[model samples]
Target: MEYVAGNVANKAGVRLLMACLLAKLHNPLVDVRKPYTRIGGSDSFSGRKYDERYIADFINANALPCNSTSAFLTPAFRNRNAPLVMGLELEGRPPQLYTYVLELLDDVHNRRVEPENLLAEIIRWLLINRNEQQQRIESLLKTLRTTHGAIPLSSEAIVGLIEKHMSLKGTSRIPVLIVAAAYQAAGQYLLEMNLPLQAHNAADVQTGALGDVEITFVGDGKVVTSYEMKDRHVTRGDIDRALQKLEETRKRVDNYIFITTDRIDEQVQDYARSLYTQTDGIEFVILDCIGFLRHYLHLFHRVRTEFLEAYQSLLLAEPSSSVSQAVKEAFLSMRHATEAG
Candidate 1:
């Protein structure tokens, strides 16, 4: 169950994982319990053949999001039966997922938790998560159909609209939406300013980019400005990490900005200020998330409607992991209400 839950987006070894578990539960003496079992009439004979077949068509054929693929090719999959081939031997997309699975199994093995009770609780959690997500999607679909409120026109109205989304607890990546939206809607304006915007990196993706948002020059593709986002307060330690990343990447940027939802630390601000001269004119600064959006909307007041459209587009386009289904609907609902036209 830990393995099932942890391997949310990356489902390489997952199908075979639960399949083997089910096989064991159905028949304790089944050889399919081991991933590499070559029992003549086991999986290859009983189930579908071809280890290299894709699981995507199965998911589509079933009309569900379930990912059921062969784990035989996955690194460390053959190590499943071995004592040493625990989590690290499973999947590499998420490094800790296999470890998390081991911890869950260990709890059961140690009698720390009754397998049945834990299974029941896990089922409950998964159900609730699924139900809530479905409810949100249904609600969003409802909103997407109707024109909710007047289109956001003013900077203040737009700020209030965004504030509604930010107040949505557990949607940490929502902050990035505003930053992305600003750049997205102001694409023309940014081009005029000679700061071409790049696609905002997904919260979960690592694109080897310095920040969540990077603006590069038109000709050279060198990042002119980099924006790192934090849902919490800025810290000196965070600054140290930013500095280290700069050092590691050996990339120079004219401006490096930290956008955060929480209050700025005076000491941290002072430290960030010091980086300007210390790094020979590379500006390192932190700005309030909402404040930055507010400024951008006002500065490009003519494109206020475009900004709202861009934000809505972002909310819906983002993956469920980055922006929850509920958060996406909440924004739609708020937008529908805030409109006067």
Candidate 2:
């Protein structure tokens, strides 16, 4: 509990721990304390298979993004042939949590503690964690509620807060939230421009969506536009894969945009623009993160406060796995700073 409270920002570790515990709790037939303690042998004993069936589902059920940096992405849990030695020697784990978990598991394996009793405690911990997460989200939602008589942030100040948010160390989530928020905020605004948005939070590839953000009119099944957020520089290969997705979907998208945080590749930009004729008028546009925000802000300056509120709403809605507690508090602080200034 101390480890979790001390490193609440690292939700990956927490998820990993919970996943293992849930895997064990869910499958009583498995005679293991956790995924790392399981033996890798027959179909009945492989830990990897156990994890493959359950871990991603656990993440999705809890609304985690299943990002690559997450322990969910690590292959260590999938070592079906590995046994108790694995946890004993598990290396490269995040600070403190791994060590704490290791000690608990070691006690159970050594017969110093009862596995059944500890598993019960594990399930209890899960409930407690859920409650804490709920409270945190409630707090943020309350902050956004102007009914409490708090001053609403100006559109200009919200932009500045976002700029600061993007610059913060360890908060890589801000960029994605920016795009999602803009899509959400542009509800009536986009409709006024005759281009309604299907403002879906970018689910992981498992959800089988064409891209991160899809633009479509209400009651229309076809996606007219899609935005894919990329942290890396846009590359031709990336475009090729995207084209393959377009071909696979056969959904006839009108516009495909890549909102990248890295510098735009000039040669790649030319390559993308030239594809207009080849793809039969499927326009591909690449813009840096801030540039895209600027264009959106300028286009919707009349309702920028609407955008700010929408962004805050979306930002606060994100799970701790995507946006950490510290980051959320930082946002509230930034809002207060803006209001004071």
Best by TM-score: 2
Encode model 2's per-residue lDDT on 1-341: one tens digit a residue: 44642355344444455455555556645545445444443313434444456665665576443332335345434344344332455444474666666666566556676666665565466556666766776775566453435555555666677888877765666666677677667866565122322233434345556677677765565678877878779899989888988887666788888888789889999999999999999999898888778778878777677777777776776665566666776777677566656
Indicate the worst ten consecutive residues by lDDT in candidate 1: 43-52
Which lDDT tens digits does candidate 1 get at residues 1-341? 64554345554444444444444344545433233444444432221222334333543343322333344445645433333233434546676665655565556445676545655554455456556666777776676557645344578988987887788875777776777777777867576222422343322135567887777644457778888888889999988888888888888888889999999999999999998888889999999988898888889999888888877877776645456555777777776666633
Per-candidate clashes come to: 6, 1
- TM agreement with the true structure for every prediction: 0.63, 0.78
What lDDT is obtained when candidate 2 is compared to the true structure?
Answer: 0.63
The true-versus-predicted C-alpha distance at residue 243 of model 2, in Å, is 0.9
Tally clashes: model 1: 6
Q: With candidate 1 superimposed using the best TM-score fit, by how many Å does residue 117's alpha carbon deviate from the native?
A: 26
Off by over 4 Å in 1: 1-152, 192-206
